[model samples]
Target: MPKMKTKSSAKKRFKITATGKIKAAAAGKRHGMIKRSNKFLRDARGTMVLSEPDAKIVKKFLPNGL
Candidate 1:
């Protein structure tokens, strides 16, 4: 059988933590930061775990993650 391929985009946007959780960058901080509040920008400065349902789907794209 052929080797399963990893989704390039998912690989770029998601990371598998040491504990096996899907860690992703928070959204809304990608552009136009000057207009956003300081609090909002500060809050988006970290990674977030995907919900159980969403994680299930994401794991398919990252079998090694699960």
Candidate 2:
């Protein structure tokens, strides 16, 4: 049988932590930032760990890691 391939888009968007948790950037900061509040921009600076259920889905796409 052939080896399973990872999802390319998911590979770019999700990251695997040292402990195997999925980390992702918060959404809603791509455009229209001029109208957004300072607090919202400040709060979205770092990556966030996905929940267990969501992480399971993402793990399937990152077979080899980033």
Candidate 3:
């Protein structure tokens, strides 16, 4: 059988942790920071683990966890 190819976009955006959970940058931090609250910005400073359902979807795009 041929090897499955990982999605290019997924490879760049998501990472599989040692425990297999998907880690990704928090959303809503890209722009319009003036309107966002300080607490929101502080909380979204680092990567976060994707929820179970969302992780499952991303897993398909990454056949080999990265």
The alpha-carbon RMSD values of the candidates against the true structure, listed in the order shown, are 1.5, 2.3, 1.5
Worst 10 residues of 1 by lDDT: 57-66
**Candidate with best TM-score:** 3
Expressed as tens digits, the lDDT of each residue in 1-66 for candidate 1 is 887889999999999888887898998987899999999988888899988788888889975965
How high is the CA lDDT of each candidate model?
A: 0.86, 0.87, 0.93
Order the candidates by TM-score, highest first.
3, 2, 1
**Model 1: lDDT of residue 1:** 85
- Candidate 1 residue spans exceeding 4 A from truth: none
Which candidate should be chosen as best, given lDDT against the real structure? 3
Instruction: Put down candidate 2 lDDT per residue, 1-66, tens digits, no spaces.
Output: 897888889988988889888899999989999999999999998899999998887787787642
**What 10-residue stretch in candidate 2 is worst by lDDT?**
57-66
Cα lDDT over the full model 2: 0.87
Which of the two candidates, 2 or 3, achieves a greater TM-score against the reference?
3
RMSD in Å for candidate 3, one decimal? 1.5
Q: What number of clashing residue pairs does each candidate have, in the order they appear? A: 0, 0, 0
Q: Spell out the clash pairs found in candidate 3.
A: none
